[model samples]
Target: MSEHLASIFGTEKDRVNCPFYFKIGASRPDIITPGLDSLGNPIPPKQLQQHFGDLYEDLFEELSKYGEIESLNICDNLADHMVGNVYVQFSEEEHASNAFKNLTGRFYAGRPIIVDFSPVKDFREATCRQYEENICNRGRYCNFMHLKKIGRDLRRHLFGRYRRSYRSRSRSRSRSPYRHKS
Candidate 1:
């Protein structure tokens, strides 16, 4: 590490810290969770652009109607489309709180938005595989045989549970203190 960056990060650099380690709070509000990589590490801003699409703009546009915005982040990593988290820092905590109070459960781009006061949590993946399969069966993105073969391959790849969860093995990594047994 460069001396300048070292001075920025402080000396206890060997240990991994949560992305929020340098932030003010011991625990962040549900508004944001750190974006994660496939191995579940924090992702950079450039990578986060793909996941939430234009939702960030939509959010800021909505929230700015109420107050000046400071920062907005949609936390998704390089792996899947599921949102690992989101973070929005308002100019004032009161604005943040007000945004949370008014926006929670409000619909945005059709789906109801969830406003969280603590660090962001993972949003469940859509079982759109079923829909994808149906579409493939109709020969949209793929054919039935191809989908079946992929399913079979996945099953064989992940201990013979064809239609379970891609996350099954990944979730079993037993590293995070936050990992929950399903």
Candidate 2:
């Protein structure tokens, strides 16, 4: 192996670290946990967006502690593997590794956190194009990531700071952490 490669990947041949890692958190169907409202009732459609916003904020605040997050995404796809998957892209590989190590023992929303290095080099490939245009024929069951939509105000609050730094980087990765808008 080249010296540069050796230094980057480290001597441990078992694990390889990268700038991106995704956490499989409490996967839900269509971004709602259902019966999340008071008295265990289903959240009203009117308040569903608020509940999702709350979730998005909580995740960003918790995950940002590990590093400077470049992007964070939650998959809205209903497929078993893609559902409610939280993908975090850090500015550096070390940050991603730190998060993986630190988050392993932690729990979120009463569920154990599952963190791992991502093989996904491109979100575009995994993204459902139809969903972007709001014309997804497959709905929630699509194999591609159907990312949830977040309120514009909340998005600015969460990602505005990152945007300035991200502009200097690749535009391919500007999108981060939003909720599924119905």
Candidate 3:
């Protein structure tokens, strides 16, 4: 994953012209519910899925300002090292680049977000075994996203306004601020 991210975002000296997708790390200890386990250790993965869902919605709305998003997958599984990871795929490389540039190092939920280009080209390839069977024993430890379809009506409405505002902003930027002296 690091290698793929480097290829897309490039090194300090060189950068890629366009990247297809990017991932955001918004995981934080605070996101988990405050509670202790049987051993008196702080139990993680406690109702954080709901928190992640809210984060996803906020991110989707904000990132849409840059461009059209093809897919947004938030990893709900705490198993493995992928918990609290979000992968966003954009229709264009420019959009991905913009999102990467803007979101990297930004704080979310009181934690700094880690943003990087993702090597994943297809989401279906990363499906969880337990999710498909509906018997995920790991529960929160499962390392795959269990997603429900976002309403198309909401998406359409949001994107429509975004496009209009984006166009207007571009137009305004292109116009000259100074007027010819009469």
Q: Decide which is better by lDDT, 2 or 3.
A: 2
- Give the candidate order by descending lDDT: 2, 3, 1
Clash pairs of candidate 1? 29-117, 29-118, 29-119, 30-116, 30-117, 30-118, 31-116, 32-120, 33-120
What do the candidate models score in CA lDDT, each in turn? 0.45, 0.71, 0.62
Local error of candidate 2 at residue 22 (angstroms):
12
Clash count, candidate 3: 2
Cα lDDT of candidate 2 equals 0.71
Per-residue CA lDDT of model 3 for 24-99, tens digit only, reads 2222333432234547686465344354445667888888888888777766556444555677889899999999
Residue ranges of candidate 1 with Cα displaced over 4 Å: 1-53, 78-84, 119-182
**Weakest 10 consecutive residues, lDDT, candidate 1?**
141-150
TM-score of 3: 0.55
What TM value does model 1 have?
0.35
lDDT of 2 by residue, 118-167 (tens): 77766776677899999999987776788777889998998886776558
Q: Write the per-residue lDDT of candidate 1 for residues 1-182, one digit (tens) a residue.
A: 57756664533231234343232112222332335675878777666544434455455567776555554544322222123335566667788888888887787646577666643232122122444445423222211111111133432533333224446656666556575565
Q: For every candidate structure, what is the RMSD over all alpha carbons to the true structure, in angstroms?
A: 22.5, 12.6, 10.0
* Model 3 ranges off by over 4 Å: 1-53, 147-182
